[model samples]
Target chain A: MNKKIGKHTVRLESKPRIISVTSVVGPKEGEGNLKDYFDIILRDDLNGKESFEKAESDMMYTAVLESIKKARLTEEQIDFLLAGDLLNQLTSSSFAARGMNIPFLGLYGACSTMTESLGVAAMIMDGGFANYVVAATSSHFAAAERQFRYPLEFGNQRPPTAQWTVTGAGAMVLGKEGNYPYITHVTIGKVKDYGINDPNNMGAAMAPAAVSTIYQHFNDTKRTPNYYDLIVTGDLGKYGKEITEKLLKEYGYNIRENYIDCGEEIFDCETQGTNAGGSGCGCSAVVYTGYIYKNMLSGKFKRVLLISTGALLSTTSSLQGESIPGIAHAVSIEYGKIGEKK
Target chain B: MNKKIGKHTVRLESKPRIISVTSVVGPKEGEGNLKDYFDIILRDDLNGKESFEKAESDMMYTAVLESIKKARLTEEQIDFLLAGDLLNQLTSSSFAARGMNIPFLGLYGACSTMTESLGVAAMIMDGGFANYVVAATSSHFAAAERQFRYPLEFGNQRPPTAQWTVTGAGAMVLGKEGNYPYITHVTIGKVKDYGINDPNNMGAAMAPAAVSTIYQHFNDTKRTPNYYDLIVTGDLGKYGKEITEKLLKEYGYNIRENYIDCGEEIFDCETQGTNAGGSGCGCSAVVYTGYIYKNMLSGKFKRVLLISTGALLSTTSSLQGESIPGIAHAVSIEYGKIGEKK
Candidate 1:
């Protein structure tokens, strides 16, 4: 009856299935490498809304509704909506939930929200609390910039280590019964601070926590790098990816062959002038829901270890000279495997 | 097997028990009506810390440690720590979690986070996901004031409707095996917006949400307002409480006699000079954990419904001329009844 597997990992007895997924991106992201993977691409960031904040909420709404529709279920069927975003007070997700009319639980794992919500959703489903749950997250470049950095109109100079915040939203429907990829395990993370205080270089700041969770996941599940066809990290950009790889090697695990950072994979940093790469709640969200989920459905990858890393630092905290505390949650998904019925 | 009852309520089959509770507050809250109920009261807001933010984190850390110690459980025995605060990025909770080293999930529902975390903790415990879970939330007046309004040194004039943010933290330990008040039901709320744009009048902004969740809880459980010994709202203050009562009366259910708002109960507005009342994540948290939990344990009250209301608005959102969205989550706790053995 014990679902917990070792220190921080959980092995669900009834693995929850991902029934449907949807991704929406702004024009800049749409023009990126995974353009074909996105469901809807807005021509502009505002999407005809008066403000970027409203546009972000609309993107989340569209993603949630589209995901539900794809799952062949009505809004009434969803037992809970678990969501969060980078905006203060989770404005985007909360506003989007107002129109959905579902029971809601607002979470804040920063950019790791996608995996955090997915882990909680699977736990609730496996625990027999709900038959269906929707997990979603969103981010807007302008919205995040004004809150976390400078205002959009500030035109502040970006450092080479600074990463671009992706303007997008992603939603996934998890249910008790489905023929989709099954969420087998979840490793909740501990808040780890390495004293990296640079807000612009979030990749370096979050890398340590990503390595911590990755090592814990492998230790708890007793699975080596080969156990997963793809080991993906959420938004650790090029700089953080290198740090993670180096740290993992020191921990006696080499994930060099299979590991890839979602931020680095989302855009061609050289040609796009994105500095380090992409970073935000939507960075890994769109990548996972769009590219990874589709690939799993096509049987291109059988097993995946998806770890979304988040740098938990606010503009106020950074200004106060506090170091960034990072967290990374790992969710193991396997394709072509059906979990036992409740 | 379906734990969900009606539209938004879930009836916990196992009925997770609250093992222990702890509350730590600032001098202002310690001088309030429920002064004697708090476990620890600081002499000042900063608690010897250089910054109010660090002081809030310290309070949270103390509360979490005290709650775990009171439960007679080691840190390793605790499966998860679910927590949040009013600070941007949940810095207080995240910093507190770092010291505890427990698997952490940072939640944000504005001031409603106490009930939000508690509900999720109970569900996880009842669903057999974990034997022990800790739910905690904190808020600091100085921290919230500078972030949401004027800086502490600004000496700005306050509005009559503005409620003082409580500087405190409260934590509760929930376990599968405990002879304490059992969580019977939880009603998750939907975000409701009625175009109330003023952040100072949060009570007016959040009242409808409190009404919505309370109504749904009564409807789902098929119970009247008088079914319980008491019904308390999180931080609706005087204005929101009146609005909620009027709204409930229009729905053909009157809760005037049995209802009390934690904000209203915490500080006497006339004597304490808290314009509307005390309002923050810690308002309901300390009140519930310190006074209500103790009373329930002594059998002073058999059944109670605690609804925590929150105005989910950020400084940026308000500056952008957006209306505040409100949310409220209700948790029904009952004593003198033993649940099934683990």
Candidate 2:
């Protein structure tokens, strides 16, 4: 009856099943390691839009529509659309919401928005407030590059610590009950900052928060690392992943055996020349909705934990000599009936 | 058991109560119409901070702490802190969350965040998921000026249609049971864009969406305008308030008698020179938490509907020749016992 477990985790009595999912990406993402996992790939980055910002919105719009279609439901049947993006004021999500015609609640969890949104939608269904809800998020490489750093037209050098912002979007329709992968628990995160200010090194900034949520999820759920088939962090990239592994170990949790970061898994960093790896709201979104969700449906993964990490820093904050605050939310989605354990 | 009503309204049978609320504002807002209602007024806009961004975060942080104190709850007792602001990447909120050490979920409904968050927290309590939750939002004039338009130091001329962003923050603690103003229903909105691109004319851009949600709320709940003692829109400003009045009449609902705009109520436009009026996440926030919430406690208002409206547009999107989108969410807060209707 009481959904609050321990401290921050919510144990959903009614596991909200993700009915259908869709992932859309730019051509560059289509050339990545898991290229075949995506549902739609744009012809180019611009996707015929006048600006990269519109293209980002169009990508999310396509994913939302395709996701609803994949669920075999019309727009009229859906109760709510919960979405957010990395863009300023969340233009991408709002623009996409315009066409959906569902009750919309825009969220902003930075890159961690994917899991944060899922957690909210899961609570809505588990609480028996809504029948069906769509949770989605997005980001664009050129858009982020321009908004966060230099303009795309202005060529600039990047540090190896920097991660490429994925030009993609992903959407999933979650229902009250179904035979699909069900979301069972959600551990909302705390904003943590270790005084890292460099925008180029977001992984370093976000890694602490990723570990904080992941640790709390385990502590509250009373589940060890072995309980999950895989524990995936949002976008900690390569360097942050290493930092997370070490920090998590100090907390007496050794997850290196089954741990993977979406940022690192999205691209073959060596061949793709993606510096550290992929990062953005789209990175974890596409990886989970595209790769992880597909694999779960195939029974390749029975129990999985997704921790979407975010660096809560604006250009203004960094310019004002403020540190990057980080946050990460973990949601548990499992397939096959759990026999009280894995 | 079904909490959702006919369309977008969520009928909270348990009626989560607002235990306590706090409002903090800058010097300019402190000199406005609702001056005496605010809990804390900063001596200066900077509030001894190095930048406007830090001051914004501090204002929200103060409101959060004070609200918790007023509720007689410690940071540890609060289950989740749901907050957002108009700043890019939601830095103000995330930074505030850093010190609280509570589970955090950042929202981005633009200015509508105040209601969007309350709706989420209400559902969480109604669902018996959490015992207590906090919903907060803030915005700063200097921060908005630099981020959305020209820097304050640049001294750019503003159009008469442009509304001044309010420099304030407000927070409220919601609990499952309490003897305070109870939240009864929530109507989530849809993003509506009528192809308005002028950033200076956000009132024009947001008015339709405010009316859209208001009409939907009344229709879904089968409640006439007379059901509410007061009906309020977030920050539609003087001009947008007129638009809403005209549009709602077309919907066959005459709410003009009791309808008031927070943007208009917060400032004496004639004396304050706040162009159209005060507008920001803080405009509706401080007005409601400081003035409206207090009135409800004193039984001056029996039933009130707060529709926090938001204009969803980023500078980049506008620069890209995109139109401004609007979204508004309505939350029903009432004092004393409701005998089915006011």
- The number of the candidate with the highest DockQ is 2
- The runs of at least 3 residues in candidate 1 whose Cα sits more than 4 Å from the true structure, single-residue gaps closed, are A339-342, B339-342
| Model 1 per-residue lDDT tens digits across residues B1-342 | 578888888888888889999999999899999998999999999999988999999999999999999999999899899999998889999888878779899999999999999999988887677888999999999999988998889998778888999999999999876578989999999889999998989999999999999999999999999988899999988888899999999998899999999999888789888988999999999999988999988888888999999999988788778899999999999898564331
Score each candidate by Cα lDDT: 0.91, 0.92
- As a whole number from 0 to 100, the lDDT of residue B174 in candidate 1 is 95
Q: Put down candidate 2 lDDT per residue, B151-233, tens digits, no spaces.
A: 98898887888999999999999987757899989999999999999999999999999999999999999999999999999
- Residue B161 of model 1: what lDDT? 86
How many residue pairs clash in each candidate at the backbone level? 0, 0
Decoy 2 TM-score against native? 0.98
Query: Once model 1 is optimally superposed onto the true structure by TM-score, how far is the C-alpha of residue A123 displaced, in angstroms?
Result: 1.0
**Clashing residue pairs in candidate 2, if any?**
none
Every model's TM-score on chain B? 0.98, 0.98
TM-score of chain A of each: 0.98, 0.98
